[model samples]
Target: MKLHAADILVIFWLGFLTVSTVKGSVASQIAPRSSCVDLSTQQLDIRNLAKYEMQHIPVKAVMFITRRGIKICVQPDLKWVQNAIKFLDKRPVTRRPTTKPKSKPKPKPKGN
Candidate 1:
């Protein structure tokens, strides 16, 4: 019973493909039923979200929009979570900037 390099590669690929195709994954089964979701901006409370999670209802992660308009998901209980909430609360929501449109003229257009 000897395994070679090619045997190891085949075994790895087989495991990867099997895991990818399986509908019920080990990770999904192990998700904590009582995770936190803190949406302070939307008046959504943490306790309410926890209740939903405990009932096996999927609670989406709390997200924030950065200056660049990139959406970032953060865990509620992180040390910096409170600070981030405060920061976002204090700032006004601005229009998300889009990718540069192809205009043949001004490199830095001053027109608003």
Candidate 2:
């Protein structure tokens, strides 16, 4: 089999195109959906908040996830929001015990 410069270039171009197409699709799938249409200004209890995620589409806002599984969209520039984030960051993390406790064995009954 004879090798040519044009043939090598064609193979390289095809490989690049395949990689680019796959990368674009994967990126779209990995990006989170934009769910915030309205931003809330109401004050939220820091104790109820579990975590937060920053959203860019539709509007730039902070999505706060409460411990009760509620999602609240708030303006990122709000003073309370910023303070809440700082408080959450400094709060201690509580984790559930992973292992089960050992069970006590029952005493054997006396033989008749």
Candidate 3:
């Protein structure tokens, strides 16, 4: 059986997409998911933020990162909002370390 360039290209593209899709799904599954999200950054004060479903919206999700840098996403309901709040309040918001901002180099004195 003879395979043309198009056939090979199609197979390669399909395989690449399949692998990427699988990888994405696996990565998502590996990520932590729950009702209460623990955040690393103290920047967001979850205490005041409203995370539950709003008047019109049926679902609302909260995203935060752990001290260990694990990101978590959760939807609010009756059962877990309080628990999540407590968990966040207890842990000090350890902000993600920021890299030094690159300063613009002073205009090089007109090259001699």
Candidate 4:
């Protein structure tokens, strides 16, 4: 393969951009650390098991931790799940509020 200075520069630039973008995406995905609600145990549970995924249950006092690879029920984090529910409840539901129409200004008369 013929090596060229321009080719190396282009590859380096592309790799830098890709890394930066991935970092930004991962940062955005992970919610900022806040005292709002604690879920330390839940997070550990998510990372430890190879085949497991957590799902928040709003109404019920339990969080589903189903196995991923084999797809089976593992265990429910009732207490932590409840805390998650509380956290979700505290979050504000953003919706555009309806408002009445405002009167428009009158048009000025044009000179003949």
**lDDT of every predicted structure (CA atoms):** 0.53, 0.90, 0.56, 0.49
lDDT of 1 by residue, 1-112 (tens): 9999999999999998997878557656875533435443333333222111111234445555444444444555555655556555565666779899787875786778
Count backbone overlaps in model 4: 0
- For residues 1-112, what per-residue lDDT tens digits would candidate 3 score against the true structure? 9999999999999999999999999888865334443323234435444332212123355554544554454544434555766666676656778999999989978877
Query: Against the correct fold, how does model 2 do in TM-score?
Result: 0.58
Q: What lDDT, from 0 to 1, does candidate 1 have?
A: 0.53
Cα RMSD of predicted structure 2: 6.7
Model 1: lowest-lDDT 10 consecutive positions: 47-56
For all the candidates, what are their Cα RMSDs to the real structure?
Answer: 13.7, 6.7, 11.3, 14.0
TM-score of 1: 0.29
Predicted structure with the largest TM-score when compared to the true one: 2
Model 4's alpha-carbon lDDT is: 0.49
Off by over 4 Å in 3: 33-112
lDDT score for candidate 3 against the true structure? 0.56
* Candidate that scores best on lDDT: 2
Q: Candidate 2 on 42-92: residue-level lDDT in tens? A: 999998999888888889999999998899999999999999989988888
The residue-level lDDT of candidate 1 at 85 comes to 65
lDDT-sorted candidate list, best first: 2, 3, 1, 4
